[model samples]
Target: MDDEVRELNLTIDLCLRIGEVLLSSGAGAADVTATMQSVAHHLGLRRPDTDVTFTGLSMSYQRSPEEPPIVLLRQVKQRDIDYDILTRVDHLVRDVLAGRLDLFLARSQMATIVSVPRSRRRWAITLGWGVMCAAVAFFLGGNVVVAGTAFLAAAAIDRLQLLMSRRRLPTFYLQVAGGFVATLFAVGVASTDLPADPSLVVTANIIMLLAGIGFMGAIQDALTGFYVTSGARIIEAMMATAGIIAGVSGGLSVGALFGVSVGRFDPGRMLDVEGLAIVVVGSAVAAAAFAFSSYAPRRSLAPIALIASGATAIHALVIAQDIGRTWAAGLAAFFVGLVAYAVAGRVRVPPLVVAVSAIVPLLPGLSIYRGLSLLADGGSGTSMGLLAMITAASVAIALASGVILGEYVAQPLKKEARRLEDRLAGPRLVGPLRAKGRPR
Candidate 1:
C-alpha cells in the first residue's frame, strides 16, 4: 500500500511539472491539459482530472471511490520564449507516451530540460534580435542605412530591457522602456542628414516588441473553450501592447517639441512586384532571426525561413490583387498553420515554434504605429487614428484565428484523425494527439 501511494505521488508530480513547462512556454490551456492527462494516463493514473489556468496547473487522481484523491498543484512563475526547451520537453513527452521511457527516467529528463542553461549566449540572442529588426526595416522598403539604424536601435532596446529584467522590473515597464528607446533612436536619426526613413525604423522596432506577446496562444485558448485562461492571456497581451503605446506616445511628444517627426502615416502603401524578391528575402531572414533570438533549436532555422518565405509570397500576391490586408494576412497565416505540423515533425520541434516564428513577419506593426502617430497629432486625424487602430486589431484577430483554423484542418490529416475528429477536441500543437499504450 505504501509503495503504491508513493508511485501515485510521483506520477502526479511529473504531470504537474510537464503542465507547468507547457503553460509557461505559451502552450494553450487545452494543449497543456491534454498533455498532462496523457502523461498521467500513461503512468497508470486512470482518469486524472486536470485543470489549467494562466498562472497555475493542478491535477487530481483517485485510486478508487474507497480512497482519497491525490491532488498536486504547480505554479508557473516564469514566461519566457525558449523554443529549445520546448522542443526538448516535447521530445521527452513523446518518449514517455511511447512506453520507451519509464516514469523515473522521464522525470530526470524533464528536470535536465528545465534546469540546463541555453546553448546560445545572451549576446548572441541580442544580436539575433538586432538582425530581425534590420530585416523588418528592409521588408518595409527601407534602404541599407535605415536597416542599419534599426539594427542598432533594436540591440540597444534588448540590452536596456535585459538590464531592467535583471532588476526584476515588470514586463509592462520593460516594454515601455523598449518603445521609448526605439522611438528616441528614430528621432535622433530623423534629426540627421541621412536619407533613411525614421518611420521605417520605428515600425520595425514596434514589430520586434509585439512579436513576444502570445496573441496566437490567447486566441487558441478562446477557441478551445478555456475562457478564463483566454481572458487572462488577452488582458496580459493588451497590457504589454499598451505599454508600448505609452512609451511611443511619450517619445513622439518629445520629438514634436524638438521639431522632429517620423512623418505622416501612409495607408495606401502596398507591396509592388518590382521589390517582391527583396521583401521575400527580408521576411525569411526576419522569421529565422526571431527564432534564433528566442533560442529555437538550431536545426529548425532553415525550415522556418522556408515557411516564412512562402507565407510572405502568398500574402504579397493576395495583396497585389487588391484584397483587404486583413484577408491577406489571414490567408498567409492559414498557410503557416497548414504546413507547420509537417515541417515541425521533420525538424523535431513543436508546431507552435514554426507557426509563431513564421507569422512574426506579418504582424500589424505599421498599422499600430500609424494609429499611435495620428492619435498623438490629435486634431482632425483622431478618427483616422482610431480607424488604423481598429484595422490593426482586425489583422491581429485574423492572424490568430486563421492559424488555428489551419491547425484544425491539418490535425485531422495526421494519424490521430479519429480522436481529433471529435467536436470537443482541439488540435494538438504541443503534445501527442493520441496516447500510445493502454494503462498498466
Candidate 2:
C-alpha cells in the first residue's frame, strides 16, 4: 500500500511483461531471463532473482539481507510471434537502459506496447503460407499441378487452423487436422490423372506446420542449460509433429481402404543450374512468406528473403557435392546464423527473427513425410522408416546447433562493436543514477 511497495510492484510488472513478450515470441529462456534481470537492475532494483519457465515467469526483489523479498509471478498461457511488437519491446529496453525513460514513462510505453492492436493481415498470412508451400513444392521437384495442389492445400489448412484457433482448439489437434487435409487432398489428387508428384504436397504442408513451433528456441534453451523450459518446448514440438504423423497415417489408411494408392517419395535432383536457381528462389519466397505470416515489419522482409535464399543456395551447393543431408543442413544453418548476426543489425531486425524464418526452407519435411509414408505402407520398409526418422531428428538438431555455434562466434565481435559505439556516442541521459523506490 505504501509508495515503496507500489513502485516495487510496478517495476516487477514491467520486467515480467518484457520477459513474457520475449518468451512468447520464441526467444530462448536464457536471453529472456538475462534481459529481464538487466531491465530490473537498470531500473534501480539490485540482484533480482529471476525464474523463467515455459508457462510462467517469476522475479524476487530483496531490499536487504534482513528483509523478506518481494516476489511476483506472471503466467503466460498463450504465445504467438509478433515481430513488430518484438522490435518495439527491444527498443523500449534500449531506451530504458539509456535512461531516456523513467518509471512513469516506461510504464506508459509498456502499456502502449501491450495495447497496440494486432495487425489485420490475416489474408496476407493465408496467402503467404500458400505461396511458401507452393514454392517449396517446386523446389522439391514437384510439377506444376503438384505445386498448385500444394498451394490450395496449404491455403485451406491455414484457414482451417485459423478457424480452430479462434475456437481455442489445442495446437496438437490443429496439427492433426492440418495434416489430414493436406494428405487427403494430395492423395485425392494423386488418384486422378494429374501426372504430378503428389507426395511433394504432403511434404510442403508438413514444413508449414513445423514452422508454427519454435524448434530453434527449444534446442537453444536445451543447449544453454535451461533444461525445464527446453523440455517443455521439445515436448510441445514433438506432440505437434506426432499429431501430423498420426493424421497422415490415418489419412493414408483411409485412402487405401478406398483403393487409392498415393505415390511414394522420390527426391529429385539438385545438381543442375536450373535446380540450384529454383532452390534459391524458392527459399527466398518461403522465408519471406514465413516472415509475413509472423507479422514481421515490411521493412525487414527483403533482408529475410536474402538471408534465406543465400542460406539455401549454400545448402544446395553442399548437397550437389554429395554431402550428407545432415551435414549440408548444418553447414547452411551455420551460414545463416553467421550472416544473420551481421545483416540483422544493419537492417535493425533481431538476428533470431531472420535466422529462424530463413531456416524454414531447409527443414526435413521430406524425411518426415517419407517416414510417415513408410509407416503407412505397413511392411518391408521398417528399417528405412526408422532411418528416415533418425535423419529427421538429426537434421533438426544440426540446424539448431549450427546456428548457436555461429552466434557464439559472432557475439564477441558484436560486443566489442557495441562498446566502441557507446564510447563514441558518449554518456546517456540517466548517467546510471540510483534513485529511491518510493516517491518523495
TM-scores of the candidates are: 0.97, 0.92
lDDT score, candidate 2 = 0.81
**lDDT tens per residue, model 1, 15-88:** 89988888888889888877887888888887788888998888888778998888888888776699988888
Writing each residue's lDDT as its tens digit, candidate 2 over 313-383 gives 88878877888889989999998877777777677777777788889999988889888887666688877
Give the candidate number with the greatest TM-score. 1
Model 1 ranges off by over 4 Å? 265-270, 416-423, 435-440
Please give the lDDT score at residue 240 for candidate 2.
Answer: 90
lDDT of each: 0.88, 0.81
Residue 413 in model 2: lDDT: 60
